[model samples]
Target: MTSRHLLWSALGAAAILILIGGGWLWSLPPAPSVTPPLPIAQAERDATIAALKPPKRQRPLIAIIGINDATETTDYLMPYGILKRADVADVVTLATKPGPVTLFPVLKVEPQATTAEFDAQHPDGADYVIVPAMSRDDDPAALQWIRNQAARGAIVVGVCAGAKVVGDAGLLHGKRATTHWYSVKEIRGKHPTLRYVEDRRFVVDDRVATTTGISASMPISLTLIEAIAGRDKARAVGRDIGLPDWDARHESDEFTFTRPFALTAIGNTAAFWARERLGIELKDGVDEVSLALAADAWSRTYRSRAVTFAATADARQSRGGLRIHPEQVASDWPAERLLPSVADRRPADVLDETLHAITARYGARTTDFVAMQMEYPRNRAAQ
Candidate 1:
């Protein structure tokens, strides 16, 4: 054969192979999770709780830290709201700097204090420091502050992909940890010395703790409440939040990057012209946990992004006292653009309700895609 013809033949052969490989991958289901069913026994859970107990103060000072520009909504807010509701610890929200924190996929919140301000106020450091996922994993200021808190005997907790920040801070070395399902491989590779445990919503090894994903924040906060106050207090808070029991139990295997999920995300993204800017109303006494979850979930649909609207441009204080800045005036936002009201639902169940609403509007695959993004287990049968 001529050289050109041979080259053409090789190119055709390569194209055919590429198509076959692509088809195979596209047809295949998500890889089965290798996580085991080894549930954390009560004794083990108690031990972890005890390990994180405050060393000195009767009411431990807890700080939930976020980045100024971009922090994950639920990851930063759920813990603050839940812990505040529990009232077991003196909870404060701190930003890495002095500005309103712009949450990913939704809302903006004013933090209670800046890291520098907190440090100045309490020279002894916080009893527990909660880290949420930020837009940039390698923000030098955040990393240094986390490292300093860990060094000062604060039990550091990393929620969701905040594990990356904690790992970057060099505290997860030689510790057993877990993070968002989507982040497991990347975070594990980043911190090879850390043993990555799965099938649990949260993992604690010594003073450093890590959780599976965004929704895991609720359980982890409950666990922290249990650690500081008692199981009874945690349960009381959990019941009030619509979850009667909260533990480390999680079916990590259930959440994965499946073909259907990928297709839904791709399809939604490709149809960007149809994207809508849905608004949720902000008001005094709104549940911050519910607001965060609802806004975060709706924004992840790819079909829509949630924006907050209030009567005025003024900030609204949540039921738990987090200050939320509305994106627009309520009158300015069209009534049609408002998302299905989650205002009537209990704070904890709003996410599930929003998921159902998504399923109705988009489809089950899109709903699952949103759930997977949040690392929320939608299969109640398995639970």
Candidate 2:
């Protein structure tokens, strides 16, 4: 009886082991393929169908306003440059003269279009007319023509003190505007009827638009595109252009405090310069302590760009009944492509370093720093 039971037990154990071993020895189940299915909607099919569809590049004919030399490097070019980065806008260099107009350097832009030449046939031409601030806005004829364009539906844009020309033409009588900070008081004084605002990078008063200057021009024009077209389309254009913080600041108009709309002449320029180069405004006043604080803040925040300095005689300059004396001028980018030219580069396009240096140096001082005249790099497209 014991031998039989042992035999039965041993047989049962062997049977179980055999089953387990058999299971392990057997081949594995087949795995599913890793290849993904193609997208259901054929982009190529859509492209083929789309290729047959008519072209969609309805570019706005942007005509720039006429001014002798009051025009700025970025003022006229920023929008032109930024917009040209898109397929939606064709930047026609419109000058008072009908031929080639000379700019910062050998950048003699042959006037492809002109106010009189184009305006004669299409009196109500151009989807947009951009006015850049010049050294002076004394052209009555030009101002009159601008009023005519504004009277029509053309969206008028001004950069920095370019708003002064729009204001002078009576376009900004009730419209709110912003300009280069230094000219704020004088602009307000002359155009007393118009409401004045300050310290803003740019302001869009209804259809009318204005920017502080330089880089601010990028956002201002892009916003205009958003309004005319759609936000998505504007986004595409901005992205296509490589404008990094393009639509990032399109904040909701929620309950929030904004900057003051009025400022002192020197304080305004100081505030503007500090924000762009030094990255913060100087400490409240125009005295040595505040100046040092501004320079000190600049050096700390922008250690790479700013240099040490002591206040010099030429560090100060006076404008509109105020004294602006900065201790130093410096702010530099890490880029190696931005040194001044051996000879003025054709297209008058200088690199950005000089303007940055001048801006940093003259933080609360003279408002006249030469700007980086942009030459739209060949085929101005996002890399």
Candidate 3:
């Protein structure tokens, strides 16, 4: 071959090699680049972290037990309302059977779940079980259920006469406990093993806790909330429910009882005409103190024979679960004339305004009667 033909053949061979190398490079999968991208903003990083985080755990579960004709209204409801308001616990009202549990002072409560249904839903049992004061002491099913809950390592709480149920359940044996002052002797006699402690609002022995009176339920519940959700959370809950700086150790005897009774009498008297106008509805209910006051005032009023008093249009239910049926609805009555039940937990300003409004509407005679009733308690306390 000539010199020019040899040079052309060499260029053709070089071109074939370049084509083969390019085909091999194209056949190979692409490799990821190792270079870092632009730095993320701190706010963007935080938002990403928040978005990827797991959800918070659910609140603790609490089960309140009630019985027919035996359960006291306050004992069952106060804690329920308080715990629910706390927003820390999942509180449920349970009973041995379904339907309304007739409470003392003629109130009735329909429990949310039966024992069987509760067990079915929560096979692990409750974290806390509350037993309210019951009139009847011997309920085999209730007693057995209490025992079962205790055996499963759940916290057991008894309020007032509810301590009797715990005692009967055999949980109170060798446990320090207290009950409603009136039932102290009876409870001690019935449960000889129980060491009855007086003057304390509530006593805690291991997982079991017992409180003294119907009203003691509130503080004890706050204590329980403090335990489950920390002191700060409990205090917040207390403040929300109109109790600020609540301490469970504070005994019920610290307050002057006579003043409440006197106020109750006054409230009842004021409610007389309103009751005549509104009528009473026991199914709707009234609190223990309010009910007592109304009853007493009804007995004393001249119109008591002619006019029947009712709690509310729907038969009002009280905080303690007293149900009263009024003969008429108070909706038509003058707003100032309506006797509103003022609980001690109410803010001083709100209470003062409420009192002023009521007295302003009722005239000086009504205010004079209240002042007179109040004076006796002050004098008695001073002495």
Best by TM-score: 1
Query: Poorest 10 consecutive residues of model 3 by lDDT?
Result: 374-383
Error of 2 at 279 (Å): 28
RMSD, each candidate, Å? 7.9, 27.5, 34.7
Clashes of each: 0, 10, 33
Q: Mind giving the per-residue lDDT tens digits that candidate 3 earns over 156-234?
A: 8888778888889988888888876546788899888889764456777767888776656766777777766666886
Write down the lDDT of every candidate, Cα atoms only.
0.82, 0.45, 0.56
Which sequence of candidate numbers ranks them by lDDT, best first? 1, 3, 2
Cα lDDT tens digits, model 1, 337-381, are: 777665656666888788988998888878887888888876641
- The collision pairs in model 1 are none
Candidate 1 runs further than 4 Å off: 1-21, 24-38, 381-383
Task: Give the number of the best model, judged by lDDT.
Answer: 1
Q: Which 10 successive residues of model 1 have the least lDDT summed?
A: 1-10
Better of 1 and 2 by TM-score: 1
lDDT of candidate 1 at residue 19, scale 0 to 100: 46
Judge candidate 2 at residue 298 and give its lDDT. Answer: 30
In the predicted model 2, the residue pairs found to clash are: 70-133, 70-134, 70-135, 71-134, 105-348, 107-347, 198-261, 328-361, 329-361, 330-361
